[model samples]
Target: MSAFESIPHFDDSRAAAGQQARVEDTRIAAQQFRQHMLNGPKVRYFESFDLITVPYPVRYGLRNAFSRERFVEYMHIQNRLFVVQFDTPDGLKTLLVSPSDHERNIETPFFRRLQDRTAAWLTKLIIKRQSSVPQILERIGLRPEDVDYITYDHLHTQDVRRWLGTDKTPGLLPNATLLVHWREWESAKDLNPYQADWYCPGGIAGIPESKVIGFDGSIMLGDGVALMHTPGHTEGNHSIVVHTDEGLWVTSENGVSVDAYAPLLSTASGVADYAKMIGTEVIINGNTLENAVDQYISMVQEATVAGPSRRDPRFPNVFPSSEMTPFWMFPGTRPAFYVGHARHGTLQRP
Candidate 1:
């Protein structure tokens, strides 16, 4: 038997000490993360939000999901998995967005084979130890049970069945429910042939129906949060809108960088200007299976829903949700902005 499996009891002093160290380490990590969110450099690509925060996986510190030439105009970017928490009457309602593929075991034949052919830049981004969602949660002081709902902008390269469990196995988050758009959920179930390589095979297959909650259109999840349909990249693509002290911050892969969303203000002015001159607004092509017209429309929706850009010169409150970058680059290191004071939008009491 393995040494871990052979442990007879849970009360061993060494084990207890290890547990304590883990918790303590996690607490320290959380504190540092809070600082990073507050103090990280406010890249033009990101608009600062006072209410919403990135509570876990401070930085993946890897390159863009897209390759070298895919986004040639851009220099480098990093992918970030954000644990966005919102304050609500029901208590702290947590939403886990863009949770990356944490179940990819590097030791497996699949990873081994892929790694042999994988580019050097992607190697650091897909490290197995850091990619496991369960370990990530533990490191961030979040009990999987604490997650009320989990969803992604789309179903690209996801393996959520592991999180939701099957008929025989239990899900990692016992109390959590997956909130997915109906179209997106269906698209995942019936992946297109051309997009086969982009999605996780059987990502959502065989999950208990009770664990999935499908929404038809835009649904408000109480206390300054809402899910809105923004399809263009994929038929089921959507973005999460959070009302923060700085205004609305959206989470999506539709626009890879702030420049994609706001071309006029981006560094790629020559190209952005040319596109606008011709009536086409340039946005990052998230999923190849997309409609340019639809993508333009979706980007408009995101801009419209987002709160007004700030006037402060130090850091304007507007940015792309995640920074997608190539290797040899790191994510923003600014400290957390919204400490404990997240001014959520409220409704008129009838």
Candidate 2:
């Protein structure tokens, strides 16, 4: 049986009490996690791929950057794949988090409809040959069979058939199981109109049930690693949490950079001013406004769990899986602070 634990208290309600309750619950969970697992075996982390740079709406990113003509229309986001390895009671475990298949990802309706060959030219120009996951795995001396689990924060623009295989095609990872939340798994297979824009159609189709693990609530893979449901970006969105010598670090796509988590500490041109003007603690990614209140509270939970960054104590260690990287193409949208890649411990072959 898998280690399944009830999520302490998750209140996504719009009431003020629900908001405060969420914050308190998250703080309590953070305390317990640190107390019990802070010194547990550290996971070996590596940035498996730099992946791709895509345009993101500025209004969705900074929220207040909406009417500002000086700011770029879109922010260039660099999505990355992370390889995390750790020892568990069962055995040595390797998890591929956010292992996005870029070429297949473009099949999402939003990108597919972009005409004038813009998408094709951009893909040829921006995608780097060496940044493919297969190459990175080989370079790091890991075989396809070495991966035990594959997961993403949410399944937006992701087509897992390439990795997990269908009836006709062979899978890239022969022995890997896809670990995902039950809600997310269901939503991707049968998307609502509200969700149609971002998700790739037929993304999760045709995989044998045995090859997938559909879980609910928060789960501890082992030691200091956790998959906690943070929601808001999507209903089933969760954050990857890790404990290292430095401190706890959380990864998700709720926010694009350090500026979103700690807007007051942001040196980005208008981020701090906007947050101060609105009297809000954190900024939402705003791409989907369906559940802004829930998204707002989820960001608080992530920041609480991540604690402070050793590099910059003023900011929390809540990193974005698709981070906002500096691009000359979009000059004014550069993130004042970005955690380019997080590497911890050494990768030991199992």
Candidate 3:
């Protein structure tokens, strides 16, 4: 029997009870996460509503099947939204991260084809278990239009327009500058071909190349905020390090979850690129194997630490790797305290 068939009937009271228990478990987990953040070393933290949940099958389909799988998944997946606020000597500075505006449907023909295939598979699996997609949605109580203007770790095509709108809004503290990782804005073409139609000639192209800041090892964005290049996943990936009265806080664009820091397996089955494979292995391991497998792992880890940092003023190349700091914001981690520092050097309280 398939994995779906091994479970109890969907309508069974026991199964229903189990589902309720799962929901409660998720809520408890979220609550604990918030409480942990509140008690962390940081001075203050702000959280927004959790609007949407990207279905696992859909996430899998997009990441493995989409043309620009990595970029797409990095920008839009598991749609949760939140913003963190820190207290600085200057006042209150907010670090907006991980705010997803909307759940997108695959509109292009290529994506549509892949979606159709996955939908068919989902239909069979779900129907076999006497349930439907809507039923699952009902269980989760997710709304399509639930979100806030928080800084997101990943930004998709839609996010750019929304950002522009937000930036142009009048009477808001003009001091707030959108702190973008220098690399994300630079390597748009190589990372996402679909975005080429928009980001290429007329969009980012319209902005003078002179305004683009390539990777500097680190740059003070005024008021103690810093932009650091932490490359690995892509040439353009970077991290934002903000210095507050409380402490130094770093926000990474591609730094999704703690698991992302762990070693990744090869991507050889669906879309295979030998160069990417070698490069990825080298990045993860630091160099080609010259010893036993375990020894090689150790060598890679060391190399990863000792490798030369890559930062180009014109290209947005930042750092030796994306995993710069070992610390992560998990459920039980302590928060840091710091003073407010704006992206453009102005200090403000919100």
Candidate 4:
């Protein structure tokens, strides 16, 4: 059986209709109340283990509207980001999840003086033409005063200052760690042009290399939850996996969206080179490891270059096939699913 067959088909229309028809159920209200205490007040959040449905505005072309669906559709499939408050025993931690480094405006004087002109130039350009991070926060119903931690899957502009330890926000958590991919923290500046500010003074001082956690394949965070390295999008791309009484549910960060992945081959190929190198060195260690590594790399390169024309034979009936399909299919279509058991582990309602 393929990965696609192993998962259930998420009915978007049924869900949309159900949400549309939902009366103010007292159960929902009670659950929201509990979530409010857990996540904290002034928390306006959205979650999608699948595709993110909110249409956040993007800059460029006539398509640059501040609509959610438009943004979702534009990205090809749903990519989720959350404006949430992560509450711990110590206190409430407010964070904007998954803020892209290349998607924020950076006007700091320190960044303007960077030595790497190419990266610096690109940073400025991305900032000039990108969506405003503050605006995104507002759209997601988050208030500046309510924010404490800006957690990110990878280094994005909003998370950069925190990562670099140069953020001047008053009463900000002094010891809050900027969780990021260890590989990106080590080599992103050279590989990704958007990371120029990360290497600068204001940026560099705050983000010490010591704060990073380099785990093989996955790492456990908070309770029993784990973050798995799924790779493919960027070298260190990962998905958040929560093991609840409901079984195992994985949040496809930049991995394959549920809708897209439903039809096996519709899944976008991840980074072939990294996958091969890591898989060979780690997962597939054996006598034929060398050949397996070479074959894996070659297969990834071929699939990548072949684009949509290359289809995995397992599931051939999927439509709108293309290797380079955009991230979201429709804005707000990829709502995050809360997977948990009905009896023991329930998804905390918002």
* Highest-scoring model, TM-score: 2
Model 4 lDDT on a 0 to 1 scale:
0.32
Task: Give, for candidate 4, the lowest lDDT window spanning 10 residues.
Answer: 1-10
Indicate the TM-score of model 3: 0.38
Among these predictions, the greatest lDDT belongs to 2
lDDT of 1 by residue, 210-236 (tens): 988887655656545656666767877
Residue 340 error, candidate 1, Å: 19
Tens digit of per-residue lDDT, candidate 4, span 17-126: 34222212322432332232233222222232222222212221001111343233223323344433333444444444454333222332223343234465543432
What is candidate 3's CA lDDT for residue 160?
29
lDDT, model 3: 0.30
| Candidate 2 lDDT, 70-110, residue by residue in tens | 55677778888888887687777888999888778888887
Candidate 3 residues lying further than 4 Å off, grouped into runs, are 1-43, 46-49, 55-77, 88-90, 103-158, 166-176, 189-216, 219-228, 240-257, 262-350
lDDT of each: 0.51, 0.77, 0.30, 0.32
Model 2 scores what on Cα lDDT? 0.77
Indicate whether candidate 3 or candidate 4 has the larger lDDT: 4
The TM-score-based order of candidates, best leading, equals 2, 1, 4, 3
lDDT score of model 1? 0.51
Q: Each model's TM-score?
A: 0.64, 0.91, 0.38, 0.39
